[model samples]
Target: MKNVFSGDFTQGFPFQGNMTGNDPSGFPFQGDFSKSETQVKPQPEIFETNDFVYVKLPMPNKDNKNLKLQHTNHQLILINYPKENEQSKYMLPSPVKRKGTRARFLDDYLEIQFIRLDESNISEIDISY
Candidate 1:
């Protein structure tokens, strides 16, 4: 007999549940866990070059004229895009020059570009104890 106190007892044991094969929730257990299908905001792809950082958002079967964009140094939003997924924030890999930022909608994607600035000229400060 394999018991907790017995030296011959193996650590591994078969999982046991209700004899009727129902889950602890008192419902017949089905392997499926997903309950509902809900629409979610789509994510954009971002990339960078020596002179610019670009973001590309997808909009399949949607009109380009309906797309609107707003952005700051660290955040961006596409107004009324699919209505549900209009806002998203991203962390930039490097600093960009915001003054000449540009955006365009083409085919099924909205693309935005931020000019990259030269960081080599930035100076470092020293702190003393």
Candidate 2:
């Protein structure tokens, strides 16, 4: 007779009790996760100051040329090279000007700043009854 479970260990156990959950072809990798083609979205850190709202996102060794950033008064969308896309929206602590927002990528982090608008300058329009 021949050993039924001795053909290939990488192909998973020949029995029905396979618990590795890997492909029957043995994990499809020798043993390295960095080589995976899947893209993971990066998280961001937000902060507020007296005059500005800031957002910082970490992305290591990524070139700035491939970075794309877009925003509205309350929402932001970001995308980095090779299919990494992330988006977020927040109720700002206060109102921002929304016209002079600025951003830059430095030290493996993307930092964005939006200038706050003075509420006192906003005029209230009285409506007629």
Candidate 3:
């Protein structure tokens, strides 16, 4: 019986003899990944500091009069943006209070600042196991 852990174990595999000479990383597949039709749309940038959570989104060819912004504790919503009657929703990094939100549109970018909600009131539960 042949040992499966031997060097020749890959002889009967489907990827056998499929290694390409031009691939420096020695991957078994061959394809020009750079020519692939995978395009990435612009995504919102989110960051949080000690006091605030910031979300910056690109608003190319957009106007403040045509945009509407709304938010809950966990999500931020943009309406009438990028196109008429179209809306985009973004998730916030942390829970935010509804009162202290500030939004500004400048230089083709929409920046929203949300005050972080205090979540440090965790209580220890006694397990009755």
Candidate 4:
């Protein structure tokens, strides 16, 4: 018998799943990961020429008006509110300024521009800084 444990086709090394079928019984999150599983990884494009950081959120089919942008002394919070999604808030991973920030609503996408001031920003105010 071919050792399933030592073979590449086995579920030991590159494990696909224990089930033979696509729809596993006990396993969850097999399909439909476009929603509720992961948030659109915020893509921040720093426009040094314009002194503004253009942020593009990859939230497809989501209402642009529902998106909210807020910044604290610690991190830049990008809150995305989908009309069809449950109500909740998400804190951003980076610290950015709230002031001078602008947002625009596009086709099912929200494009925001965070003005990077030449002066001290929220990140600079960190205690460790």
Candidate 5:
């Protein structure tokens, strides 16, 4: 089954539950994750109720309070800039209205919430007419 993210990829590339080691020939990929430079961003679990849109961003070891949330042109922009590195950006899979965009920091993660000012509906914005 696909995840909330949609698409077959949501099922993820099937893991053996505790299997390590890849193709010795390295046909597809190489390098061990145990010694990798950067890591793939973990997908956060987003829960939507009748009143608000909850987006949980998983980022650790940084001051989450510094993170910012804003909406421009109806797109939810999450800017997380670390003091020692460049700023990171994540896009909400679904469009978010700017009506009431706010965020909270807890447990090293940033929880952004958007108020459903215009009902929990997806409106397609088409400027080409």
Candidate 6:
């Protein structure tokens, strides 16, 4: 007589046939079964003073040679940083001018400064009924 549950079907199951203590399918028996690849993104700090809006980003293991930075009136974009073919964007706290933008990388951080746009120039439109 032979055992019914002692065949090839139970080879990969826990505490079963062969008892070799290894999964032949290359899968772990317990803990952290996630098989997906995950990427970590850097977070940037943005603030504004009376004259300038500043954005400071943590950029570890990076240099100016491969870093690309761009911006518009309300957003800042970083490219080729943290990893190749990857990009990140940061929103500015206040609107900034197109000109007089400056950036520097120091102490494993990227600091950008932009001139704040004049809010007084905003004009109110009257609603016509």
Ranking by lDDT: 3, 6, 1, 2, 5, 4
Alpha-carbon TM-score of each model against the true structure: 0.58, 0.51, 0.64, 0.40, 0.51, 0.66
Q: How many clashes in each candidate? A: 0, 0, 0, 4, 0, 0
In angstroms, give how far residue 118 of model 6 lies from its true place. Answer: 0.8
Q: Which lDDT tens digits does candidate 5 get at residues 1-129?
A: 455657766245554333444453433345675526555455676776766777787667664465565665334555554433445455544455666677766887778787655545588998986
Q: Write the per-residue lDDT of candidate 6 for residues 21-93, one digit (tens) a residue.
A: 2454454354443334345577788888999998888877654477788898988888886678888888888
Least well predicted 10-residue stretch by lDDT in candidate 5 = 19-28
Q: Which has the higher TM-score value, candidate number 2 or candidate number 3?
A: 3
Off by over 4 Å in 6: 1-36
Stretches > 4 Å off in candidate 4? 1-50, 62-66, 80-97, 120-129
User: Per-candidate RMSD vs. true structure?
Assistant: 8.8, 13.0, 6.7, 8.3, 9.4, 13.2
By the TM-score metric, which is better: model 1 or model 5?
Answer: 1
Preferred candidate (TM-score higher): 2 or 4? 2
Candidate 5 vs. true structure, TM-score: 0.51
lDDT of each: 0.68, 0.65, 0.80, 0.52, 0.59, 0.76
TM-score of 4: 0.40
**Candidate 3, 4-100: lDDT as tens digits:** 5676666556554425434535556656644235434469999999999999889877544878899999998888865678788889989999898
lDDT of 2 by residue, 1-129 (tens): 128657655456344533343544544334434425544545578778988988887867665465677666666666553244544444555667769998877888777898877778667899999
Clashes of 1: 0
Better of 1 and 3 by TM-score: 3
